[model samples]
Every structure is written in C-alpha cells, then in structure tokens.
Target: MPEEFRTTRRAFVGALAATTALVSSPFVRTAAANETFKIGILTDLTGSFSDLGGPGTGVAAEIAMQEIGGQVLGRKVELLIADHQHKANVGLALAREWIERRDLKAFVDVMNSGIAIGVNKLVGDYKRLAFYSAAATDKISEDACNEYGIHWNTDTYAQTNAVAASMIGQGLDSWFFIVADYEFGHAMQASMDQAVKKAGGKVVGAVRHPLQTLDFSSYVLQAQASGAKVIAIASGGNDTVNTIKQAQEFGVTRRGQKVVALLPYLSDIHAVGLKTMQGLRFIDAWYWGMDDKSKEFADRFYARFKKRPTAVQASVYSSTLQYLKAVEKLGTDDPGKIRQYFLNTTLNDAFLRNGRLLPNGRMTHDVYLVEVKTPEESKGEWDYEKVIATVPADKAFRPLSESACKLRA
Candidate 1:
C-alpha cells in the first residue's frame, strides 16, 4: 500500500481500538442495555474529510447530550463513534454492527454520501433514525430517502443554487469547474451546472480530480486557460483547502478569475487563510458568528474543541439535541413518532433558524451567502465570513414540487 494509505489505515485501526475500549468499559457494560439510548456517529475520522467532521462531530453530539443533562426519556444517553476511513464498506459495516449489537437508536454525522445513503437504507430496514450532518449529495433526501432519515444539514442543491445565481447575477456568468470525482462533487457540479444554465450563464469548461488529491496545478491551469470568469470548486474539506491554496499560488484569482467554493466549510476557510480565500463567495447553512445564540453555542463548543464549530458540526449538535427533545416529548424512542414530530415541527435552534423538516426527509432552513473576509477585515480567530445575503428556507433548497423523492410522490 502507498505510505499515505498505510498511515491512514494505522490511524483508523487506532481509533477503532480506542472506541472498542470505551464501549467495553465497566460503565458501558454495567448499565442495563435497556436503560441507555445509544447514538452512533460514523465519520471519516482519519481521512481527508476528518478535519471537517471527525472527532469534532462526536464532541458536538456530547455537547448536545450535556445540554439535555445526558439523559433522554429517562434513559442515559451514550454516544458511540467509529472511524469509517471514508470507505462505503467500512461505514456500512460499522453501522450494521452498531444496530445489531449496540442497540443504536440513531446514526449521526455520517459525512460520506455513499455511507449516509447506505446507512439510511440500513436504518430504515430496522426502523431506526439517521440524522445526516455532513453528507452533501441530494440523493439522501431524494431517491435514497426514507422515513427514518433526516438530512439536517445542507445538500448539493442547497449548497449550489443561491451562490451560483448570485455569482451569475454579478456578471461572473461563464464558469469552469474543478470537481472531485465522487458522489458529492458530481452532485454539486450538476446542481451548479443546472443553476448556471437556468440563470442564462454557460459552463466554459470543467475538470475532475480524484478524492484526496494533493496537487491541483493541472486542474487550476486548465481552468485558467479556459478563461472562464469563474472557476467553481465542487468539493469540500482538505480538497477545498488545497484547491484554493493552489489556485491562489498559481495566480488564478490574481488574473481576475473569480474562484467560488460551492460547498466550503468554515474550517476550509480557516485552513486556506483569508489572504488566499478573501473575496471568495460560497453558500453556508450556518456560521458561528451569525447571531447571539450561534455565538453562545460556538463559545461553548470552542471551550472544549478549541476551534469554532463549522456548519456540519453545529448541525450534529442541533440534530442530536432536537432528537432528544422529540423523544422527551413523545415519551418513546420509536422512529415513527420522532420522525413525525420532526416533520411537523419548526426547528429553532442555535445552529438552524426557522428550520422545517420537509416531507421528503429534507430539513429546510435559511442559508447564507457569505464572503470570505480579508485578514485585515477579520476581527479575530474564526471570524472568517460576512453574510452577503440570507437565502430564506423557501428559496434555499430544492422545491418540494420538483423533488424526485418517492416519499412526496
């Protein structure tokens, strides 16, 4: 195996061992299985997406548990975490194990789209709930959607729609794309393509790169040569950080080509730095500095994790807390009851404002069109974005009338 793969595997093994030890400890063993509510978080703990939604996702869930006094419906809540290494098979296996043996009541923070879709199906088969905080593909709320699944965070259509239209309106009409060759990237780019065309803009050119790619020079050069007014990045996490860094190094932006990150996290901007990513625009579901409630939650989250929470991390926290509230209100952990409560209720939380769970298993909420602040413009650490506009819940996501989900049909 390549050294990188070997190193990643080693780290994953270490995480798995640690998780096993935690779960097998006396505290977990002595508790009657019926007295605990277990929520499993399957994430890319040691892969390229780790920084965006790894250990922090678990921390977010724990914070949610603490907010609810670590008990729900008279049952002590426990969190189980596993490193899926960004592989579909590894993620599915972990989800299966948790459901069959650990009595996992729900699955959260599934970052990989393939894994999220698979887990949604698995949980549906067994009548459990899944809250997706990181998966980006719209399929989770569309073709693969189930009554047991709730896509709490943003999806491909939500991520691309507002930003693409806003940029196109700014006269940055022609576009070229540097897409990650995966489900997330493919969906994001397709969304962007559709949005751009609908807005009367044209795609000049596009290039696809493998996941976890270190060098983006070829892709950046191709986009620069295309001379498109905008170079759209249809990826996230380290891939986004690296692409932005290299794009700046190659003077793609200096040459007057606007580079837009279709699905960037707050962590991505932090990694790339303001000087490189400044003036870049993207759509986001939440920002830590957006409001007083957001700031309060972010302060507490930073106190433990030492980093401001991203939208994905915040979603994990909000979804966990809300799920527990649903259980409390209904007096049971039944998937059907909790799912119904979520769909009928308007979710108002520090991380999501006026959120509504759609019939298609999509949680619709207001998303922001944010611009990266320059280093001088930033007030302090984690103060990276300025909200350029707020796309209301009704306009931010794909309209239910046009949804492909069978649930709606």
Candidate 2:
C-alpha cells in the first residue's frame, strides 16, 4: 500500500471501531436505550375529581421536571398524561398502553381510588412502577399492594384515622354518616367508623348517595333526623361541598349536629365560600397557602392556571418528582428495581420531606387536621384551611403488619 493510503486507512479503521464500541456498550444494549425516561400521569381531568386532578396534576408534573432540571440520569424525562374520567376501565386501558407500548418507567397521580386500584393491578402484571399520587383508597396499599407499586399519598385509612380520631377526641362523638356509593366511600366509611368506635363514639345513622349527587336533600334529612351530635360527610370535592351546603340549608348545624367534612380540597372550600365553610373541620395532607414553601408553589401555580393547589395537586407534584428521581437513580425503567427504591427509600422535596414509602405502599408523612377559618379569620381567597393538628405518618395510616396485602405480610 502507498504510505498516505495506509495512514488514511488506519484512521478510518480506528474511527469505525470506536463507533462500533459506542453502539455495543452495555448502557446502549437495551430497548430502553435511545429513549427518554417516560412517566404517565393517569388522572381524572373531566370527571368529578377534575378540579383536584386536571390542570393541577399537569402543573405538578411540570414542577417535577423543573426541580429535576428536566433530565433524569443522562436522558431527558417525559410526562405523558391521560384522563380516566372517573372510570376504572378507562384508566386501566391507558395504563396498559403506556406500559406495554410507550415503555413508561412509571405511572403517577392517579386520582380516583377505583382507578388507582385498577391501575395498580396492571402495573403489577407488567412489573412496572405505579407511583400513586392522589387516590386514597386504603385497598391500594392493603389488599391490592404489589412489589411494583407505591401509594405515595394519604389513603382512606389515614384520612379516617386522622380526622375521625382527632374529631372524636375533641368531643364530637355521636355520628351520622353521609357516604358516596362507591369503593372510596365504603372504605372510608369503614375506617372512619372504626376510628369513631375506637374513640368511644356511637354511629347513630348512615346513608349512601350516588357519586356527584347535585342535591343531598334526602341524605342530609336522614342525617338530621338521626339527631346525631356529629354529622360526618365522607366524600370529596363537589360531593362533600354539596352535602355540606345542603346540610346548612337543612339547618342541621343550627339545630344541633355539627357537620364534619372528610377529604375536602381547597377548591371545594373556595366554592362553598368562607362563610359556609366556617368551623368545618376536615383532614388534608397539604395546603398550598400554608407557608412560604406552599405559598411560593401556590402562587406560581395560580399565576399559570388562575387556581390554587389542592392537597391532591401537592401529592401529584411530590410523587412525580420522586418517581423522576427514582428513574435517575436506577438508570433504567425496570419496574421491580424502581419499586424497591420507592418503597424502601426516603423522598425529600418541596412538598414532602423525609417521606418514607411504607411496605403497604402508603407514603408515611404528616397528615393535617384542619378547620375552615371564618371570613374574619381568612387571609385570602384560598386561605381556608387552618391547620388544627398534625398527625404523624406512623399513626396516620394503618400499620403495615396489619395490612391484608400478601406482599407486605
């Protein structure tokens, strides 16, 4: 070979060898390679939980990306969202598509409890991560838990345990329950009933109403007729607010029984106004207007959506950020590894600090029992909930050893 030709050939061979090595590297050997870390946000955007789930959840995902600097590991992070419309089948379908087709590392911020449970099964079946952000059914962490999922927010057990025990301890004893007719309501009512009984309170009466009922007249009437000292509205968003409004209209509070609303959001309280919400006690994991951290986040959120953040929104943001962190740390979308990191890890961020994911999948953090402030006490439009007490995570939810999940026990 000619000298110049020999040198050129040597350089060309060296370049080709380098390229081949880069392509065959272990990090580049899998289907997950050449793809960004993808996460799915399956929530109710147009259903009963929309106000608490829709734009707010999107905001949370964005905040997570921003906090993580828009990348996990060396790959970019992408968030794909789907609306469940409060339907389990719909949510399950979307979850399957994201997991099987799009190769999402995890799904987050599922708002409906039924939808959460349904998706929990799908994630487990596929051995993928499900970072639950909003849905509060205890079953997600109890009978439904798997090695590949984590419920990163409050559950029925936590809410009921926090609100019921705290209220009962404060002397709100005899109870009348107005429950929504669904899994969420049933589980919550069961847990609340247990807490009330445990605290020496009696359940005087109970009635179930269809979800999203416009008028709670008859249900409120039943509660009133029970003559219970404490009337408990076990529902969320529109249902809880409507029941409270109807209870006020029916003169239930003025007559004797004080209505205690469970699982209320800032949006619901804002809708009912400070006057009606005054003195109404409820349980929450977070409030956007609580402090500088919350206020800063809420202000940024309102500036974008013209609405305040709810506990659900806060939950979504915290879970999304944590999931992204898991993806970065694991350096792969393997569900089993991600699951181990999530449940066995402690997540600290703007919303949740030193939060530990429980064996039953519950996020162990502080649960707040708050009372709605009167107009005189309120500071702003979204300044409704006044933190009455904080329930430690260990005591907020049912113990893991007591859970019915085979994966936990």
Candidate 3:
C-alpha cells in the first residue's frame, strides 16, 4: 500500500475500533442505570383544598426524598409538582404529561378525590404507581382501584363510618348532613348515611352546598330545623372551615345540635379557632402528636411549613419514603414488583403504624376518633386532637369482601 493510503487506513481502523468498543462498553448500561427517577405530585396548590394538602404535600414528599438520601438505584431522584387547581381534567393533563414526557416513576399526594380518581386512571393505564395521601373518596379504593394505585390515608368510608358509628353508639342517633355538592362531599354524605343506618341511627335531613360557598347559614338553618341531634358537615378544606364557622355563628351547637366535621384537617381547626372547633368529633388517619416519631416528623415539617403536618401530609411522607425504599430494595422501579412488595409487606412508619395494603388498594391502618380540645385544653398551637377511641385497621376500612375492585373480587 502507498504510505499515505496506509496511514489513512490505519487511522480509519483505529477510529472504528474505538467506536465498536464504546458501543460494547458498560457506559451505555451505566447511563441507563443513572437515568433520573422522578416522582410527581399532582395536587391542588391554590384551590379550595390548598390548606389541607397543597404545598405542604410537596414539602412532605421532599422530606421523604431527603430522608432516603435523595437517590435510588444509583439514580438521582427528582420530584415534579404541579397544581391541578381542583379540576380533574387539569390533573389528568399534568399527570399524563409527567408520565409520558418525564418518565415519572410514581405520583404522591393527589389531593382532591375528583382529581385523584382521574389521575389514578391515567397512572393505571401507564402502569405507574400512585400513593394517594389526601384524596378521601372511597371509590378510588373500592370501584376505581388499580394495581398501581394505593390509598395511603383516610377515606370517606373510614372517616364517616368510624365517626358516625361512634356517635350513634353514644346515643346521638338522629343526624343531619350539610354536604358540599361535589364528588367528595357526595361520597362522604353517602358513606355517613350508610354508617348511620347501619348503626341504627336515622338521617333526619340533608342539604348540599356549592364548593367555596362563603355562606353556610342556610344549610345550618336547614340542619337545625330538621331537629337532628347531630349535624354532620360532610365537606373539607375551606368549605369545611366555612361551614363550621357559619354553623357556630348560627348557634347550631348552642341549640343542642352537635356539629360534627366528618373530614377536618389540623389546618381546618387552625383556620377555625379551637373555640369554634371545640367539642367537634371526627376521624383521622394520623395525628401529629400521636407518638414520638410523629412529633419528630411534625417538628421537622413545622420547621419547613410553619404548620403541623396533617394526616394527609404525613401520609405523603410515609408513602413516598416507603416507595423509595422499595425501589432501592428491588433495584428497579418496576410497578408490578413494587406493587407486590408493598402488598406483601406491612408498613410501619412515622405516619402509618401496622399499616397493610389491601388488594383493593386501601392502606389499612388504625384511625382515631378525635375531638377538638377546648381552648383551655389545648396546651399549644397545634395540640388540638384528643383521641376518644381507636378504630382498628381491619374495621376502619371497607372489607375486601365488599370491595368493588376487580383485583379483590
């Protein structure tokens, strides 16, 4: 070969060899392994439900991510948060985008039930995991549950059943409902109604109000006119706060009708003073001061958000941490494997104690029937709940035999 041709051929051969080696090397696998694992939080950041599980949920998830060292399987874990604005279509859009474009491994803290149900369907279709920390509708676990979704916090069925049954057992038999005219409110009212009936109580009257209604006087009047012993508020967030405040204004409690908030958050109590919220009974999945672990978590959370963590926010932390741990243990974020691991394992964490994941996608844990403390009884700013009774996990949630989920069926 000519000298110049020989040199050129040698250069070409060297370049080709380098390219072939690069293609066969572990760098490709390493790149794949190091790809970022992302978890998205689709929640209401600035809507009626914001105070309960909005930005606080993001903080909780971040706390969990940091607790897990912020990495998994040699991959950097990233969190993507978006406000669904309390709209199901908006939530679905954000969730679909995150799952498809960002390769989101999972979702946590989908706050509103309408939005949660929509996101649950999208997550199921994409075979991704969703840990619902705040969504209260029972349909997510009962009729709309997927193998990839888990209701990590309290649901309407659990809250209403526990609270209503407890009150009914105490001789407060007649009930009246002031419900928010939405999916969540409807579910809550329905569940409470069923619970009351099953507990040998009667629903004397029921009234529905629109979301974010500033006035609840009419509803309170209707409830009072019904002559029921217990007037239950089957709503949440700002609506719950407003209803309670208006009901108190209407002297509903003073008139001897007990006002019960079916789904009230710590923030709700804070929004409505302890005096107004005093003597109010409800069911909660977790309380900040429940144990040392919870207090520690709450302290850290309060440090960040300037508020104690609600049960929903705590569940966000718990579920997010557990999901990250499972990914670490399995060495992958495969939804099926993670689902099996979660279903087979009992979750005991700062937020959930002796929690078990049912086939219907409910994470069953003990729920507390708590009453708001009188202003004098409250020692400090977030010391509100006084646990009157503990409802066991098995009895707190709907039984699998009655589950509408095909997986359980």
Candidate 4:
C-alpha cells in the first residue's frame, strides 16, 4: 500500500475509535435557549469537504436569514454548526445533541451519505427536520428513508446517470473509475457502473482510494494503464481535487483520455483552478453563473465567502430560506407542519428552481450538464462553468413508484 493510503486508513480507524469513545461518554444536554430558533448544520467541517462546504454553508445559512429579514417565527434564527469530521457516530451524536440540548428546530448540511443516514433515525426520533444539502446517498430516499430527513440536492444516482448517459451518447464508451473507498464513493461507482452498462458503455477498470488521500499517483497510473477512453472520478471534495490534479500532471488527459468527474463542485473547480480543470464536464443541480438569479445569489455569496459558492452552499441558502419562510407563515417550527408545507407547496428559489419536496424526501429539480470553462473563456475568476444541457426535473430523479417511502406514489 502507498504511504498516503496507509496514513489515511490509520486516521480513519483512529477517528472511528475516538468517535465511539466520545459518544459513549454521558454528557448532560445543555438547556435550550428559548429566545433563539436554532438550526444546527452537521457536516464534514475539518475533513476533506471542509473547503468544499464549511464556511460557505455557514455563510449561506446566514445569508438565508438575511433574505428572510433576519427573523423567523418572531425569534432570531441561530445557526449552530459542528464538524462531524465525516464520522458517522459523531454526526448521529450531534444530530441528537443539537435537538435535545440546543433545541435546534432543524439540521442542515449533512455532507456524507453514511453519516446522513446515521443521523436520520436521530432526527426522526427527535422530531427535527434534516435538509441534506450535499450528501449524495440514494438510500436516504429509499431503504433508509426517514420521515424527518429531507434530501435537498442532487444525489449519486442522478449525477451518475446524467453523466453516463451524456458521455455514452458522445461515444466515450470504455471507462476506468477512481473512487473513494466508502459508502458515498461506492454508491457513486455502482451508479456509474450500472448506468454505463445500461447505456451500452463499459467499465473497463476501477480503483478505490482511502478518504482524504494525499496522493492519487497510483490510482492515476492504474487508470492510465487500463487504456479506458474516459477516466471517471467517483469521489469529491479534496479527494477529487487531488485526483484531477495528479491525473493532469501525469498527462492522463493530454494522452487523449477524458476525465469525467461524477461529483464535481464549484469549490473543487475553484480549488483546482480553471487553468487546470478546463474542458471538464460535470452534472450538478446548480451553477452560480447560469442565470440572473444564480449570478445575483453568487455575487452576494462571493462577497461573503471570498470564493464561488458550491452547489452544496447554494442548497444550504435555498433550503434554509425556504425553511424560515415556512416558519414565518405557519407561526410554528413544528417538523410535521414544515414537512407537509414543503411537500404540498412548490419552492422556486435563486438556487433550486421549480423544485418540490417529494414524498421520498427528495427535493426534485432539473439537473444541469455543465463544463468548466478554459481560463481564456472565463471573463472573471469565479466564471468557471458553462451550462451545456439540462436533464428535465421529472426525468432527473428516481421515479416515486420505485421508492419505499410511505407517502404513496
């Protein structure tokens, strides 16, 4: 095993042990502050996704409050954020502790699918809402569905299917996958593998890397040797960034191969820079430069974050704004009321347009096929993506008929 992989694996095991110890200890739940209506954001704060989500998500929540005139249900809305560090138990513990101790009405920004589901039962038991802005697990809306869990953005299946269909149509048939060895990565790889075969393409080769891997040199070598026409990266956050950068350095793309990222985000592009990430095509639910609404939202977000907002950050802003609006109109922060309100009404916002909160907890919307612009094509720093095609909302997500959600089709 490579040194980076060994290091990351050790850290992963250590984190698990530490998280188990932390959750086992009995700590008194803090008294709830009745003066503030709080929403806790549980995400991978200090881990690989921190640069992709952390400060931006917190800022997005604040921006959502400002959009709501800084008050909801006649109380000052408070944003409580914790870095679960991508540990499942840590996320679950925070989900329970945030509600029981802090009296947060809802939880937002759960960024890992495994952790998202781990916290699902806690959110349901506590009767607190969870809007998954970045987590990409499909089972959150399927087998692991929770009444209080609201999947607010694109999931693994949608992105994988969208990219697979588009690429296969263009005749980029044979593929090699570089994936993170975990739930989110596995799901993405599985989705892409299935989609490729179904679309008459082939997954010729694949490899898995540990989370927060420092180097993807070996993975890139394996992908290159596979002679696959397309090297599909089924990872995100820092892992995705490193893989693409290393692949470029190794001339993987220059050698007549395309690198298709299954989970590319604005933050990842920004981290990699347009100069290096040019011509990369990705499928996502939002883009900051796509329209007037997106530009307006992006400009404000850029002012606060000093960087372009990722789709995850955009979802945080939209979902929180919608949640506040629900509380403002209903005169309560009740989860049942909020869930019904979201399900029954349509939410068209600066980020998510014409989306409905589905019975299976999916926030359904159109998925866009976007490409990273070349540095010469970019008019400005954050002018990263150019929209190419759109997958219709009705056709974007999984059909309700196939879902196990209690809410009938």
Please report how far candidate 2 places residue 190 from its true position, in Å. Answer: 0.8
Give the Cα-based TM-score of candidate 1 against the true structure: 0.92
| All models, RMSD in angstroms | 4.7, 12.1, 12.5, 7.0
- In the range 1-409, model 1's lDDT, one tens digit per residue, is 1111111211433443355333321112114555688887877665677678877787788789889888887788877676666778777877787789778899867888877888989998999999998999999989888889999999999887777778888898999999999888888888889989998899998999998999999999999999999999987889989998898889887789988888888888888888888887888899999899999999998987789999999999999999988888899999888887877888899988889999899999999988899999999988999999899999988999999898875
Enumerate residue pairs that collide in model 3.
none
Name the better of 1 and 3 by TM-score. 1
lDDT of 3 by residue, 95-149 (tens): 7766776687899768778888888888888999999988889999988888888
- Residue 389 accuracy (lDDT) in model 3: 84
Q: What is the lDDT of residue 343 in candidate 1?
A: 78
The runs of at least 3 residues in candidate 4 whose Cα sits more than 4 Å from the true structure, single-residue gaps closed, are: 1-32, 404-408
Q: How accurate is candidate 3 locally (lDDT)?
A: 0.81
TM-score of each candidate structure, all chains considered together: 0.92, 0.87, 0.90, 0.90
- The sequence of per-residue lDDT tens digits that candidate 2 reaches over residues 1-409 is 0011111211322332343222211111112323767776776555566677764676667776778887877777666665555666666776776667667777766777787788888877888777776777888878888777787777777777666766788787899899988888998899889989988898988999988889889998888888898888878878987888888888887897888877777888888899888887767888776678877877777765678888778777887877777777778666667667766776666577568877667678877778889999987777788887777777776777788988665
Please identify which of the two predictions, 1 or 3, would achieve the higher lDDT against the true structure: 1
User: Alpha carbon lDDT of residue 14, candidate 2?
Assistant: 38
For residue 267, model 1's alpha carbon misses the true position, in angstroms, by: 0.8
